[model samples]
Target: MQAFSKVLRLVELLLIVFSVWSCTQERDADVGQADKRTVVSLHLGIKTQMSSGCSSCELVNKYQWNFLYRIFSGKEDIEFVVYCSDENKREVEQNLLYDVLILVDKSPETDELVVCHGRKTMFQKAGVLDMFSMRQITELLMDSALENEQPLRK
Candidate 1:
């Protein structure tokens, strides 16, 4: 009878150890995998060229799409998409896939990009014309992503 009690106690101890190890594994998994990722979409507006002195257009012509491709194509975390518009900016605005939308256009402000996060406008000026380097754009996206990671308060 005493030997049976000892065996039972050992089994209970083993179960406790397993429970602790399982909890630790779960915590590690939560730490290893990122819960939130930032999605950025770029609307190059390649089709709309009104010759209205849009610096963005000039920059696009100067560097071309290859320039952007070289910078963002390898990134696994960011989702970038480009669309062409001959006259309408609404096409870019209507997209729901991205967390941030960058619109390159002549209207609203020449040589400026309209950056929106969800329904809120984040930046009225972005891109080469405003002296915003590709690195700066990356920084902005990271910041936006971090902001999105935060939980909203009631």
Candidate 2:
């Protein structure tokens, strides 16, 4: 289940929490190959969102899905993060998730990932029987990385 931590933002105590969250390590890539070089990202926490936004979620989802279409359809060799979400909050927090995503990124590691879809495609072809698309899976890890790498509050 989704667990929301109760937070009180007293100025001094607030500073302590901010410092702790920001300084924590990013998560490791738990769903992909071991030889493509590395960076870490951690599972930060849940985000609460309005089903509707000031910006349309449809337009935003299309913008993201288009990128994946290009990568997979055109067979472009690209590496990026995808921010996925699912109703299965418990499974996700427990690291047993392989769900659809909401965002895609091209940063920090576009330089390191040179093989495009090659390794990832091979894994699927071999029928390894886990989450499909290690490329996409690693992208999710990048999302987790993003939280730790950025400031938590407005």
Cα lDDT for residue 52, candidate 1:
48
For model 1, residues 23-69, the per-residue Cα lDDT tens digits are 33433444433333323333342333566464344334234233433
Cα deviation at 117, candidate 1, in Å, is 7.6
Write model 2 residue lDDT over 1-154, tens digit each, in one string: 1232223224424433342333222213433433332222112122326443533331222333333333332221223333323432333334322223332221111111111222222111111112344455446434433533532221
lDDT (Cα atoms) of all candidates against the true structure = 0.40, 0.29
**Model 1 collision count:** 0
Cα deviation at 103, candidate 1, in Å, is 13
TM-score of 2: 0.22
